[model samples]
Target: MRIALGLSYSGSSYEGWQSQLSGNTVQDQLEKALGKFANLPIRTLCAGRTDAGVHALMQVVHFDTDLQRELPSWVRGTNAFLPRDIAVQWAREVPAQFHCRGSAISRRYAYVLLESPVRPSAETGRVGWVYRPLDGAAMREAATHLIGEHDFSSFRAAQCQAKTPVKTISRIDLSQRAGTGSSYWRFEFEANAFLHHMIRNIMGCLVAIGQGQQQPGWLAEVRDARRRDAAAPTFSPDGLYFLGPVYEDLYGLPTRTAAYDWLP
Candidate 1:
């Protein structure tokens, strides 16, 4: 039987999602717990891999097991052996055709940034920090150029293994919310797929435009350049969150978790 899992994790203590020889990655830990729970070797394939220090609000992964266990047992049993920062949220019996990665139609990510002069202390590793005020309108204008199908070479990482730089960014939305202490900004992205460090790289450019260092048109110029040097430095991954993949309705997976509603 094939099972699909919905999970959320805090990447603060992990070495990203993929299992590594170091045995510190989210995948390695998850697989270990799952193997112990199932009393058999189990391998999982995820919808997407997140970088170090990046959280996931909803991560979908699939694995096959001959051992029969109730959906609730999969969630509770696996989580019992998992770490505090990583967890299995829900489990479902998926059809054999279901693939956590290939079945995904699109992926979404969100970055939560704290625009404050005082650097983050208690929220360290949980939120991205910016000392200066940002021009939201300018950032939005710069973001417009990034939408649609295009070669995102400038924003992709050097180590990215993607075959092509071309990707379709369907939507890029920026919303700001004021607070009693510090203001927050949420940058949401929906795309067919994202290259390694793509969003973080784009965040660097958007931040530059918001800080009035670059014109809104600069993003378009960088996109045309198709060179890594044309873009801003890759931003911090602390605030980045994998909102997870969007699968077809046939899957019937929950679109979000409670963590989604708690974000600013």
Candidate 2:
């Protein structure tokens, strides 16, 4: 039988989503816990892979197993062996044709940023920090240039293994809320797929425009350059969160968890 699970984790303590020889990644921890629960080794494929220090409000994965068990057992049992920062939120038996990654229509992500003269303390690892006040309108204008299908090589990482540099960005929404003595900015993105470090690289550019270092139209120049060095440096991964993938309704999989309500 094929089983799918919705997962959420604080990725600060993990190496990333993929399993590694160090066995310190979220995938390694999850598979280890799953192996313990099933009394046999279990392998999983994820909808998307998050880098270290990032977080996931909803991450989807699927695995095959011959052992028959109730859905709740899979959730409660697997989580029993998982660490406190990581969890199995929900589970469902899926069709053999359902692939966690390939079946995804689009993926969503959010980057939480804190703007303040003082560095973050309580929310240190949960938000990106900028000491200078940002020009929201400038960033919004800069973001508009990225709103369609285009070559995103300028924002992609050098080590990215994506077959193509072109990706369709369906949406980019920016919102802000006042915090104690500071303001919190949230940038949400939905795309068919993302290249490695794509969002972080974009964040760096947006921040440059917001800080008056570049005009909004500069973004188009960077995009046209199609060179990674033409864009701003990659921003911190601390603020990045994988909001999960958009799947067809036929799959009957949950796209979110309670953790979504907690994000800024």
Candidate 3:
């Protein structure tokens, strides 16, 4: 039988999601807990892989098992052995054909930023920081140039393993709000798929435009360059969050997390 589970984690203390020789990844911690709970080895494939210091509101995974445990037990039991920063949110039985990654139609991500005269403190590792105020209008204008299908090589990482540089971004929403003495910025991105560090790289450009360091039209020039050197450096992963992937209704998985309402 195939089992699917929804998970969430704070990636600050780890080296990204994929299992590595360091044995300090979220996947390693999760598999250990799942194995211990079932008293058998378990392996899981994730919907998407996140980077170091990145976070996930909901990450989906699937594994094959014959333990016959109830769905609630899979959730509560596996979580019992997971670290405080990692957790299993929900679990369900699915058709053997279901896949956590290949079945997804698109993915969503968000970057929460803190813009203030003084640097962010308590929010240091949780949100990206910018000392200058960001211009939402300018950033929106720049984002428009990236709305449809195009080569995003300028924003991809040097080590990106994606087969193609072309990607389709369905939406880019930027919002701002005033806090006690600081301003918060939320940048949301939805795409058919993302290359390594794509969001962070684009964040760097949008932020530059927001701070008036570059004009909104500059985004088009960068997009047309098809070279990584043409764009700003990759932005911080501190504020990035994997909002999870969208799957067909046949999967019957929950789309949103409780944290959704609290976000911008």
The candidate that achieves the highest lDDT relative to the unseen native structure = 2
Candidate 1 per-residue C-alpha lDDT over 1-264 given as tens digits, one digit per residue, 9 for 90 to 100: 999999899999988999888999999999999999989889999999999999999999999888999899999999999989888989999999999999999999999999988998988998899988899999999999999999999999999999999999999999999876668999999999999999999999999999999999999999999999999999999999999999999889989988888888
Summarize candidate 3's per-residue lDDT along 210-263 as a digit string, tens digits: 999999999999999999999999899999999999999988999988766776
Scored against the true structure, residue 255 in model 2 reaches a CA lDDT of: 72
TM per prediction: 0.98, 0.99, 0.98
Best-to-worst ranking by lDDT: 2, 1, 3
- Candidate 3 residue spans exceeding 4 A from truth: none
Clashing residue pair totals per candidate (backbone < 3 A): 0, 0, 0
State in Å the error of residue 37, model 2. Answer: 0.4
Candidate 2 lDDT tens digits, 1-264? 999999999999999999999999999999999999999999999999999999999999999999999999999999999999999999999999999999999999999999999999999899999999999999999999999999999999999999999999999999999877789999999999999999999999999999999999999999999999999999999999999999999998887899999899
Q: By descending TM-score, how would the candidates be arranged?
A: 2, 1, 3
